[model samples]
Target: MNATIILVGTELLSGMTIDTNSIYMAEELNKYGIEIKYKFTVGDNIKDIVEVIEFGKDKSDLVILSGGLG
Candidate 1:
């Protein structure tokens, strides 16, 4: 199945922190033969996050969201 990982954090976009989660997730998911089609980082903006989540859901069979859930 195809998957998309959405990393939510302004620090990620601002280059303040590296997004190791996506890298690790991609590598791990690859072992299961699940392809990660898209990866995105969005600031703590709800609208943008929702939009991206929706888009990812539409394009991928599975969507994994990390960080910024709080």
Candidate 2:
């Protein structure tokens, strides 16, 4: 299966926080024969987050969201 990972956090965008979630998830997903098609780091904006989700769903079989710690 194909998957997409979306990371939502201003801290991640700003580079203050290290993004380790995607790396870990990617490793785990690969074991199940899942491929991550797209990975995105979005800031704390509703409009942008929505846009990413909308676009991601069309191209990927699964969309996994992580790191939206507000």
Q: What C-alpha lDDT, on a 0 to 100 scale, does residue 40 get in candidate 2?
A: 97
lDDT of 1 by residue, 1-70 (tens): 9999999999888888887889899999999999999998999999999999999989999999999533
Best by TM-score: 2
Best by lDDT: 2
lDDT, candidate 1, equals: 0.92
Off by over 4 Å in 1: 68-70
Tens digits of per-residue lDDT, candidate 2, 1-70, equal 9999999999998878899999999999999999999999998899999999998999999999997554
What CA RMSD would candidate 1 show? 2.0
For candidate 2, the C-alpha RMSD (Å) to the true structure equals: 1.2
Off by over 4 Å in 2: none
Consecutive 10-residue window with the lowest summed lDDT within model 2: 61-70
